[model samples]
Target: MKRKLLKFLNRMVLSIVIVVAAIALIVVLFVQFSPQFGGKASKEAIESYKNSKNYKDGVFKNTKDVKLDMSLKDMGKALMGFFKSQPNTKPEHDLPSTKIDSLNIANYKGDTRLVWFGHSTFLLQTQGKTILIDPMLSSVPAPHPTLGSKRFSQELPITIEQLPKIDAVLISHDHYDHLDYESIKALKDKVGHFYMPLGVGAHLLEWKVDKNKITELDWWEETTFNDFKFVCTPAQHFSGRGLSDRAKTLWSSWVIQSKNDNIFFSGDSGYADHFKTIGEKYGPFDFAMIECGQYNEMWPDIHMFPEETVQAGLDVNAKKVMPIHWGAFKLAMHTWTDPVERFIKASKKEKINVIVPKIGDLIYINSLEENEGYKFWFEGLD
Candidate 1:
């Protein structure tokens, strides 16, 4: 009887070992083969990054010290916080939005017009060019579909299949929310070009994007395509798509100048002097889209509060501003409508011209007089 029992115990141990090995193999394969994780910078790209002042010690550094987490213990706590149920983090109902008329967009030949698709995504039509800014239209903004929640709205302004051929796609960084793999895969063949901060081109190259279609720039770098000038400017932010690749790429804001309009996009940034610096250099913009959501005291050094959003708009010398980062995702613990609410109040106090438009509404950058009629669209949806 003792011999039989020993034999059975040995068989059980072997079975356990096999199961563990299988799980390990599955994990390794997923990490290695998944396209959503994005690509890392190649050795050649690393060599080029060495020339950048911001790239040091094998990572990109923010202009100021940023505390993403206090330590391993704090990171653990933050992880726990994310999993815990929080009230009012998301809207109780589907948010309001308008549908994009493809024919209207294709035929648009008037002044520069923009349609916000929420959470930093915009269709910028100007000078017969249709550019997409941070076009993250995926349902879940994570490395995998199961890793994140669905967007606030069940529908988008336009489906990928219906989107018109894009003149260019501008990416601020490689964060899953701002740069989505699914969206890019759908857009790669249709987009005329992809422009981004330095090192981000590595991911595009990994995704098999044609090298000729990609343009990467360092901070303060300027490139002109079809007479429209694109400038990559500094922002107080850190970037990484995975644990091992933290800060391997750069993050930044952008300045878009066309023949008749100047636009600024504050891609994710903390309240810092970079705003003032950018203002001094490219002050008095015709329009600016400032980030105004997804903030917490723990990571205060990276994201701006709504009050800071207004200040950022002012610092950039924007004649008019629209809050862009709050409408689509519940990335923070605050109520979904909190960002715009606070932002609107601050703007009124400062006497700043702010356009609070419904998502997908085509907004003329210089039509401040007409934008005054837009109502507080999110009033009852919370």
Candidate 2:
């Protein structure tokens, strides 16, 4: 009996060793090959960006030291706290079961029309031109198919193959969620131009996007395409897809100015004084689409809380604001609907105009009241 028990214990220990070894091998392989893994920034470009007195004198220098109040461990505890506090709450919405073409894409009549494609992606049509912002039409926001967040929308409003002739593509940064590899490869031959923040163009170039068609701009620098002026403005954010390359490239928000209207696209940012500076320089934005989700106290310096999003709108001097970066993925520990609900309440208190459109709904700010209040597409879930 003793001999038999010893043999069984040896087998059990060997099985455990084998399992551990397999897991370590998988992790190492993922780290080595994932696009989310490290890719070096151009040394020349990095030095130039870092040495720029304009950027040095700007808000980035001071905000780098702002420590987060929470950490990953704290986030895990917060998640438990949230679950305990809201025991009856279901975090995910029962996404509306609707066909892709059920909603019609409206033609903009002088005013801008925006179609939310989930997360930070949008289809913007104005002045007879169409622009795609961060065209991340993929099902996952990570390099591997099984590793990242999945879409909340039951179906994409329009598939990449069904897109109209895209005039230009604007990318805020090179994170996997925003600058997806599959989407870029698919749209490579279709888009007319690619506008990105400095050092981001390197990724596009690596992906075979035409160098001449790619325009990289620093903060406050402006470029013109098809009569529209795009200014790469500062945002309180960092960039990296891997552990090693954090802050190697710049992230930004954009101010798009046309002949008669202006729009601000807060690509992704944390709370900072740069918003006020942007408003002072480019005040009275007709409509602003700002990030309002995927926030946690752990990284509040790079992602704003819900109340801060409202303040960001006011800081940018926007006439009307739409909350974005939510309703798509569960990147943080908060309830899925927390960002929108908090934004709605805070906007009302702040007297800020907030437009909450459905996944495929097109919102025209000039005639927003004519359209009914934003229907809570996620209503029936919890």
Candidate 3:
């Protein structure tokens, strides 16, 4: 009887090993060939990544020391929170958006007109050039269709095909929410140039974007197109599209300047000294679009609360500031309208001009007075 029991135990262990090996093999194949997983930096690109000042050991590092790795307790909280849903986490009604037409775009001779397509997506038409920033117009924010949050609204104000030839596309990082596969594929043929931080061009290259048009810059690097000068600034965030490639690419804020107008875009950052530094370097911005949503205390080092968002605007010396990174998807546990409400209150206290435009509504930064009275539009929804 003892001999029989030993033989049975050995067979069970063998079966378990075989199953584990098969699962490992499947995961390897998935990561290897799946287009959804995206392409890693090429050998040459990896060498460039290594040479960056921020690169240490094998990963990129934030200027200030930060811990990107979550504790096991925090991980436990996140995993448990996944099964629970927050009230008013998504909009109850379909949000309104203005229709965009080429004639309207061409005729607008005003100061930089920006159309926000919810969250961090913006279409800025200024000086006869159209720029698309963080164009994640996909319905979902994950690499796989079945795994992420669907967009709050049913459709975008303008489709990718309807867009005019894009002068440039700026990507902040390699997170799935910011750098979407579907949106990149749609814009690949129409974009004139793609600008991103170091090591991000790998994904674009894999997606068939022209290498000549792709220019990857390190932090503080500036590139020019026509009258506008685009500078890659710093942000306190991490980047990775998959499990194996965390922090392989850089994240950033951006400074766009022309002779007349200066704009700052805080891509995704926590409250940090970088904001003050940016303001001192390039002060009195005409407008600053700052991230103000999808934040929780659990990961306070990456995303900022709404109040911090306003303070960052003040830090950057923005004449008029707009809160973004909300309204599109619910990536955190906060109430859906919490971000804007908190932002408005904070802005009032700080005595800063706040621009609250509806999705797809065009707000000229030079004329923010016309964009007021949008208060409580997002209120009363559960």
lDDT tens digits, residue span 105-218, model 2: 333445677788777998888888889998888888887878765777657878887775688999998788788888987898888999988778777777778888888888
Q: Which stretches of candidate 3 lie over 4 Å from their true place?
A: 1-26, 106-110, 370-374
Residue 315 lDDT (model 2): 95
Residue-pair clashes per candidate? 0, 0, 0
* Model 1 lowest lDDT segment of ten: 365-374
Better of 1 and 2 by lDDT: 1
Model 3 lDDT tens row, 1-382: 9999999999999999999999999878877887866787877777767778989887889998877778899888876666587568788777777788866765666667889999999999898788999999898888777778788888788988788688889999888778888899999998999999988888998988889999999988899988999999999999988768998888999999998799999998988999999899888799999999999888998999999998999899998899999999878888888999999988888888888888888777776673373566676665
- In model 1, which regions exceed 4 Å deviation? 1-25, 370-374
Model 3 TM-score, all chains together: 0.92
User: Could you give the C-alpha RMSD of every candidate to the true structure, in order shown?
Assistant: 2.7, 4.0, 2.5
State which candidate, 2 or 3, has the greater lDDT: 3
Expressed as tens digits, the lDDT of each residue in 358-379 for candidate 1 is 8888798776683482488888
The lDDT-based order of candidates, best leading, equals 1, 3, 2
Candidate 2 residue pairs that clash: none
Q: TM-score for model 1?
A: 0.93
